[model samples]
Target: MAQHETSGFRSFIFSRSGMVLLGFLAVAGYFLWEEHAAHILGYLPLLLILGLCVGMHFFMHGSHGGDHGSHRDEPREDDR
Candidate 1:
């Protein structure tokens, strides 16, 4: 006999029961979305603004390497 080692989560996700569970979740999610779509759409603008703010916070600050004054002390090439 041969034995195989696999994590429980990996094994379950590949099993027949896992397929059924995934299908059930898909159906449930579709119905949930259909039911609450109107409410979600009503807040779409607010959600978009919030997402933009969050994205800007991360991306804008990422270039500065978290040091706001690093470039202030350096002399510009045109000044030399």
Candidate 2:
């Protein structure tokens, strides 16, 4: 007969103590979010604007081919 082996972390999480710890973390996170809800909502607009600016800065740049000088050296369709 062969015995199966489990990792220490995996075994602990499947045990009772890990379940209690996970429950405690869930309750704590719920209360923390409840208490700070107003503060987080107050910054929502600013966060959205900042995210838009950063997204546009990164995404819009890709519209142009990255080669700045090489295009000038390539023959134009008119030349062909």
Candidate 3:
């Protein structure tokens, strides 16, 4: 039998910045579609959401806190 070692899967989701850009792209696409169809821009909520995403991306992930290295000192419960 083969011995197992480390467990659990790492998250591969976008690390804040990628998600923000994704939101911006989606909203931009929607706006372009609306403009192409000669319709009113009715997706204001999407714009607000994109703004919030951008803010969070800059504040949460664009600084030293985004680095996962600072959390190394904290002892994990599994260590006990």
Give per-model TM-scores: 0.53, 0.70, 0.31
Best by TM-score: 2
Task: Give candidate 1 regions above 4 Å deviation.
Answer: 1-4, 50-80
lDDT of 2 by residue, 1-80 (tens): 89999999999998999999999999999999999999999999999999999999889988686658877899999999
Off by over 4 Å in 2: 63-67, 70-80
Q: Cα deviation in Å at residue 2, candidate 3? A: 15
Alpha-carbon lDDT of model 1: 0.93
Instruction: Tell me how many residue pairs clash in candidate 1.
Output: 0
Q: Please give the lDDT score at residue 75 for candidate 1.
A: 96
TM-score of 1: 0.53
lDDT of 1 by residue, 1-80 (tens): 88989999988988999989999999999999999999999999999999999999998878867566978899999999
Cα lDDT computed for each candidate against the true fold = 0.93, 0.93, 0.72
Clashing pairs in 2: none
Evaluated at residue 37, the lDDT of candidate 1 is 97
Tens-place lDDT digits, model 3, residues 1-80: 99774433222225576677779889999889877754335566777899999999888876765558768888999998
Q: Is candidate 1 or candidate 3 better by TM-score?
A: 1
Write down the worst ten-residue block by lDDT for model 1.
61-70
Q: Give Cα distance to truth, residue 22, candidate 3, Å.
A: 0.2
